[model samples]
Target: MVTNLRADAARNRERVLEVARAEVAEGNVSLQLNEIARKAGVGVGTVYRHFPTPRALLEAVVGKELATMVQLTEQASQMQDIRAAMEFLLRRTLDLQLCTSGGLAEVICAIEDADERTTHAKSEMRRLADHLLERARAAGVIRPEITGEDVRNLMAGLERAVELDPDRADVYVSVLIRGLSG
Candidate 1:
């Protein structure tokens, strides 16, 4: 591990991660290692060296993308405008779920499970929801009874809307907001 890989080798590793980001969650995260190696202009052995197991590679790829959502959620939580944060989180979550419908259940499940602990991913989601809810409730825009937990569930199923009709994502999102709003 101390030995540094050549410049090309380092770049190839990054390329593999990038390509796998989208492909991994699709269940096709299992894209042929050889093909990735080819795309990365490296030998299959190099890919093996970086990721010895299929599961390890999938975890790495999906983990990185999940971290991006966590970050967005954390930032949204800190925004001064509650409505903006709420809207941003909903839209970004929807975008990710819809675009990755091929394997969304896993991602949603991953987030949901993580929210049970104080992990960075879970904490980000909670923080964002709390900030948004506080603003909405104060504005009397969201139902007083609405809890951050409800938003959690709503976010998880936002992807389900994708399966009904891809073109009606906006409508589904609207419905979600209405149902969640006071």
Candidate 2:
């Protein structure tokens, strides 16, 4: 996305993104534009020009993570062991969510307001996840009632739980995987 901007504008945008990424990684999702502007040494107008709202900035920050999730799902869908694929996808997705401190989850949860690029990434993620779920069901590895949306929301919930109790992340993942299995 930054490829189109002028040199200085690209630098400013990168600075803003760096600051915003740090804030989100630290669980400070407020992402106030003025604060980001001050921290990035850019003017408020620069911040606005680059990202009009906190969600826009957040989408920019977590865009790569969303893409990674889609890639992971695609890879998972290809594996022969459907159950192992599901566990791998869930674990890796949860790891990404935890690394971002739930920023990806926040963006995904607000799909209605997402930009076109983010929406497309989310849709692809959903489609791939549903494909994985269907394969798991056919293999009799996952519960018949569980849908892709349930998996996504459950992963988000696991991320929140891990945020609150970091030490119990492994236990939480194990329980979630077990609960989802047939």
Q: Which candidate comes out best when scored by TM-score?
A: 2
Model 2, residue pairs in steric clash: none
lDDT of 1 by residue, 50-158 (tens): 8775545554555545666677777787787776777877888777655554343354344433222224555565666677688789977688898877775676676
Best by lDDT: 2
Model 1 scores a C-alpha lDDT of 0.66
True-vs-predicted CA distance for residue 64, candidate 1, Å: 5.3
TM-score of each: 0.62, 0.94
Cα lDDT listed for each candidate? 0.66, 0.89
1-182 per-residue lDDT for model 2 (tens digits)? 75678899998999999999999989987799999999999999999998989889999999999889889989998999898898899889989998888788888777475478999888888888888899899888889999877887898899999889999988999999889984
Clashes of 2: 0
Total backbone clashes of model 1? 2
Show the lowest summed lDDT stretch of 10 residues, model 2: 106-115
- Worst lDDT run of 10 residues, candidate 1, spans 109-118
Candidate 2 ranges beyond 4 A from true positions: none
CA RMSD of each candidate after superposition: 5.0, 1.3
